[model samples]
Target: MYSEKLKYYEFFAGVGMARAGLGGDWQCLFANDSDQLKRQSYSDNWAGEAFDSRDVAEVETTDLDGVADLAWASFPCQDLSQAGSKAGIGEADGTSVTRSGAVWPFLRIIRGLAEEGRHPALLALENVVGLLSANSGNDFRSLCGALNEIGYRFGAIVADASHFVPQSRPRVFIVAIRREVSIPAALRTELPQSPWHPQTLLRAHAGLSVEDMAAWVWWSPGAPPPQKDFELEDIVDLSDDADWNSEEATQRLIGMMSELQLNRLAAAKAEARLMIGSLYLRMRPNGDDRNVQRAEIAFGATLGCLRTPKGGASRPRIIVVEGERVRTRLLTVAEAARLMGLEEDFVLPETYHECFRLIGDGVVPAVVRFLADRLLEPLAKHAKEGVFTTINGRKLA
Candidate 1:
């Protein structure tokens, strides 16, 4: 049966997180990405592989030889990310395009596939939250419009890694299925505005009203039960040989903190037992035209979003508040992997920086699994049965 064994193609396939999440039932027919380091990591973790290390813009549809049931794209978030320039999809010199503008090439490939009669049954896109507001929502609108043009109906939701792990990584996922497949009317109705159905998404695109979205589902499989017992300590590696920052370096980091941050640190220090805190250095406005580094600290059971440490300011620091003393260290690559729902058996590069970057840029496997279980698996089952189905009681067929 077509749906019994779903085959998928992955674009921007970083470290195979989406593949991991889809689990064993789904087969990845083809995977493509431009980054060699990431491809190396992908090859290391999943042996007996042939990854297409080509730029998405240059990859032709013919290169994808087989028919796939699903297509997953975790495209680069550099342009749409809040941490980077808000350069929404900028136009480049007549022909070539910028990095963020790579989404167009992705669409082009989809169109090419459709033209060749090889379009996938379902499509999934993953990216940062900033895409919703990029260019005051025009970018997202264009994206949805393109999918609509290509004979697919899509639903979007913002899933946070904290629901399944200890990190606070929140990302937006867009799931699209071919229009021919009948989706019941109940699943397409408007839902109450919440995390998954944020007001921003509803208000971002013009003509995207609740009533008009007969195909747009507010995909929520119910939130994971409150993890009151979970804590950051649960994921921390306490090996004796774990790398800890030197005393001098730790003092320097503390000294760089502003008075407000210092006060927060002092409060954590006052605790009787050791407390765990996460630190990030942000670029804040200093005066009129310049920006200054400000050390921000959060004392909570969960860590802040794990970001790629490209620069000194982007790296996240881990702080251990023990009574009156504080120890500081860079978050280990192993810890970052754990936060992203990667098992310990997952392979890593010898260089610490590369491992951290790969994890930071990749998706959380647990969140992907949640999406697959709730959205993809059910859709596959319905397709296999060749039945018109409604997610809710509302019927369309």
Candidate 2:
């Protein structure tokens, strides 16, 4: 095994959750993000590491001190998300694209690193599952093509935080290793379905076939152990004496519900035992006239996806039904943090909205750690074996 610490560069490093997932062995050589608030959180937790608060497009290879063992980026998903405008990376005129156009800068940086002979041995990127279908799979194909052009072999896996935590945060992780280190043929064979090698991803994006992917690893340690059945109560902070929403506000939300949602809420209220549920307001087509807002309530063991409160529609509201009484309130920031797989010791900014936004935008640490153990750790061992040869025909370590 390599004795020297593995260095990493984190892009779009919101709150350093990905760094946390890489664990103690990997040293972060550089970190960058555009948001001031997110950078604050990163500095608070990772004061020892070097952090650059600059836009990715503006950053150059010279700004980075050296090449890293791995480069991780969780680029913005606003443009790729289903809820947002499905702009699909924009056109030549840049009129139709969303902010996700920022992803191009990430690719530019990677290309720069490759051209300068400082490309990381491995590259990891995370984004929403919608990315698989963004632009009808062309975007994904383009991404793979870009990596392939840089002399790296890449594969992808979809990991949901629900497997490791109560939250149902599903993200797509793309891992690329330099072509010099060969991948076993047997490991590249397609499988029916797996926790790590999800069939849905393969089925959805034909561009991810074995032939298209230079090296694809399922990246699962083994069959995932059964997950614990968690309910809303398991994560809610019962100790916090927070006030419920005003009666008028609760009535207004109820007034906006559709017939189906009303029935669901009524059924939960009728139950003898106290029931906890989550609700999100969404714009839906009304009876043939216009789009109207409706409260969609889910009565299940898990909370709905946590989101940045861009508006009332994106905010998550909690519904408590105790016999004849019904109450509603905003989800506590602490609960949101727990759902994101962040530990209790992790510090949060004083502003509640910022906390919620950071957690919503952050990656699940558990999922990252799992990938590290199954992918990066093994690659480190391989690198220590001195088997990796650079594209220039130079041996690595």
Q: Pick the candidate with the highest lDDT.
A: 2
TM-scores, in order shown? 0.89, 0.91
C-alpha lDDT of all candidate models, in order: 0.77, 0.77
lDDT of 2: 0.77
Candidate 1 versus the native: TM-score?
Answer: 0.89
Clashes of 2: 0
Over the stretch 275-303, how does candidate 1's per-residue lDDT look in tens digits?
Answer: 88788778888788998887788988688
Global fold similarity of model 2 (TM-score): 0.91
Candidate 1: where is the Cα deviation over 4 Å?
1-3, 91-96, 184-189, 205-215, 238-241, 311-313, 387-397
lDDT of 2 by residue, 1-397 (tens): 5777788899999999998899888988889999999998998897776789888879988888776889898988777786777666664244554576667777788888787777888889898888788888877776777778777787788887887787777889888887777654433435534766565577555666455554445444455657868866778754336768887998888999988999988899789676878888888998798998888888776777787664233678888887777788888888888888788889888777888878877898888898787777677556657677665666657
Query: Ten-residue segment with the worst summed lDDT in candidate 1?
Result: 388-397
* Backbone clashes counted, model 1: 0
For model 2 the local lDDT of residue 26 reads 90
